[model samples]
Target: MSLQYVQGASLFTHINEVPKQYAYLTQNISTDVIIIGGGVTGSILGYYFSRQNIDCVLLEKSRIAFGSTSITTTLLQYELDSSLRDLEQYTPLENSLKAYKLGLKALDEIDAFINEQGNNCDYEKKDTLLYTSKKEEIAEVEEEYNLRKTHGFSAEFLTASSNPFSFDLKAGLYAMDGGAQLDPYKYTHQLLDVSSQKGLQVFENTEVVKVNYLDHGVEVETTYGYKVKGKIIIVATGYNTQLFTKRNFGVKTTTFNIATKPVTSFGGWPGRVLIRDNSSTYHYFRTTADNRILAGGEDISFVPGIFNEDAALEKYELLEARIKTMFPLIKDIEAEYKYCGAFASTQDNLGFLGKDPKNDKLWYCLGYGANGILFAILGGMMLSKLYLGTFDENLKLFKLDRFDG
Candidate 1:
């Protein structure tokens, strides 16, 4: 069954074997930390917290990795949704640099985890290119490349003459060791499966219906009438955080994705490096291990359309056309899977983490943007430390109220 937030079959979930489902919470329990979502972020938190020997319970209202996690494009990048020059208007250049560096660190963390846990998620690191085919967009792309170079980050600027791929390019930042991709669905289960062996209690199909704040801690109850008490509760429920607070963290929109059936040859997309266009509304392209071409973008306002099948089909068709336009040489260009789902973005293109500014007992691990999986990796490391009283100064970049006036 498709989730309310997702409108089509997820390429990752449909191809992978069914993951083991954990039993629902049927009895009252107390733990040091109660994680309120069981997607990638929550599962990652469970891995870190349990490895640290902290008592924690992870609750998922539905099956694990079956929400927005299923439909995610998962073209992991170190760059923000906004470029450095654009993000400076919202925060300092220095802070954005910190976030970017933290992103690399998060990538390293994922690399280490994959090394330690085995790479069953089709995880691979590839060079990334953020380019534009429009002549006017060259300056913005160069500015981003220069920013990275000035900060000692490795990147090569490519114009139409220096372009390496078959696709048209006005200019682009070709970054080596700059990006990666994974099957987020498999990664979530990989983490949860291992974390459960380390004393982390995981419950699926268990909805957290209500939460109560105590003087020294927080407690929550399930829809089936079971209580869970903890010193603190971390909200990893993604965009569905209205139950904890009414604050709008960022603007949510519907993004669509289309994955073609496995092709014999990938023309132009040499090395199968991940590629993203440098436009306000741009498409991203990546190749799967099984040799399928995936394209995602075509964003629209979240309201009304995320619920409309006709709108989703239109986006899917547009995305399919994009794939054919970009690589007409590929034979049998047929879309095997297409999906759309809701995602949010901030002005600075960062996710919220650490303590909730308004509540001491409640914390947030919401990773909302293009760098979501990367941000979630950062949260799993930083927030887990914050839970043990060691604060990472870099978390200031992800402050929940940083956008508030």
Candidate 2:
């Protein structure tokens, strides 16, 4: 059985056409660093290291960004649904602030890269609206808002009538600045292209069979029967890491995304405001530059054998129904495309980033939950700085040691 999310859409179906770059390790090879899982994190890390003249090689089990990164809705916002006040309970105030700042900085860096490279990825600065249908649920926004203000994050409160939505909500928290959106697949492949030009080698269709941490370097065994060694190894495999480490550090959750036909009346927002309902499984949404509505949420309990075509079809129907209520104009709208994938999430809703305690040179960047794109950019930057031997204060808060359980 194969994962739908990893299977990928046809090259011609996506917004951009990225040439397939595939390589296999048929012979013994060595590099300064070996990156596992060529998602956004590995690709960007390789790009940054290549720029620093480091000999880096990235290995992916399949195509680049063919994992959760491709299925992501790709809303680039620093507005964390995890309450800042809640984060302070588990971590230091300074650490929480650093996490917040780092997410924003990553967004800024990615935007700069897209501009500098002159890549057209439909990246746009938009406001995210946090709204709900229930009047009682409005206070959650206030509670979340107080923390944003306390942390000096720019946010505003909006009543339903204050915004352009045809329907009314109790209240919404709007992050005015530092929030942006993009086509994640295009953005990720663009990084892959740039990385290749910079001497960063990416090997697709090269599934990693095992990892051996040595005193001097890490050795990775591939399905093709060869040992590729590197000074360090970074794992961006997301949920697939469970195959190696059976520890309960990662919880798999399911989220659904449905691309509705373009909603043209869309004056209520510049499409930046993302609404977070105060439900156990919160739903959020944002619009693409072309006016298509991307709404995703309502987490389904994870079960084995739940990602098959049958399951995906059922979830697609659920999302289609939910999107209709959110946007009545598209009553006849059907899902153009649907994706179901697991995002490793921690109890605190923050990512797990650092070298594993068991192996000093084996690092991981996982558990962004619904905010992978934002943290992927941030994780890439931090990993790059760590590779460059720079002390990044922001990376400390999300250290894997936080879960001593």
Candidate number achieving the greatest lDDT relative to the actual structure: 1
User: How far out, in Å, is residue 62 in model 1?
Assistant: 0.4
Task: Assess candidate 1 and give its lDDT.
Answer: 0.88
State how far residue 287 of model 1 sits from its true place (Å). Answer: 1.2
lDDT of 2 by residue, 1-405 (tens): 125433224221264565566677678899988878777767777777787778888888877766766777776667565666666666666665666777788777877897788766677776666666778867777877777778788888777667566545778777776577777667767787887888888888888988887889889899988888999888777777754576666577777666766655654334435555656677767777766777777666666654566666676687777666666654455556566666556656677777787877888877466566667666676777787788677666677887786
The TM-score, computed over Cα atoms with residue i paired to residue i, of candidate 2 is 0.89
Model 1, span 1-405: residue lDDT tens: 126777778898899887787999989999999998988889989998998889999999999999888888789888888888888798889988988888888889989999998998899998999999999989999999999999988899998998768888899899999988888889999999899999999999999889999998989989999999999999898898888998888798889999999999978777899999987987899988888988999999888433888888898899888788888778678999988888899888899998888788899998988998889888988888888889988888898888777
- What are the models' TM-scores? 0.97, 0.89
Over 4 Å off, model 1? 304-306
- TM for candidate 1 is 0.97
Query: Which residue runs does candidate 2 get wrong by more than 4 Å?
Result: 1-16, 86-89, 92-94, 262-273, 307-314, 329-332
Query: What would the C-alpha RMSD of candidate 1 be, to one decimal place?
Result: 1.5
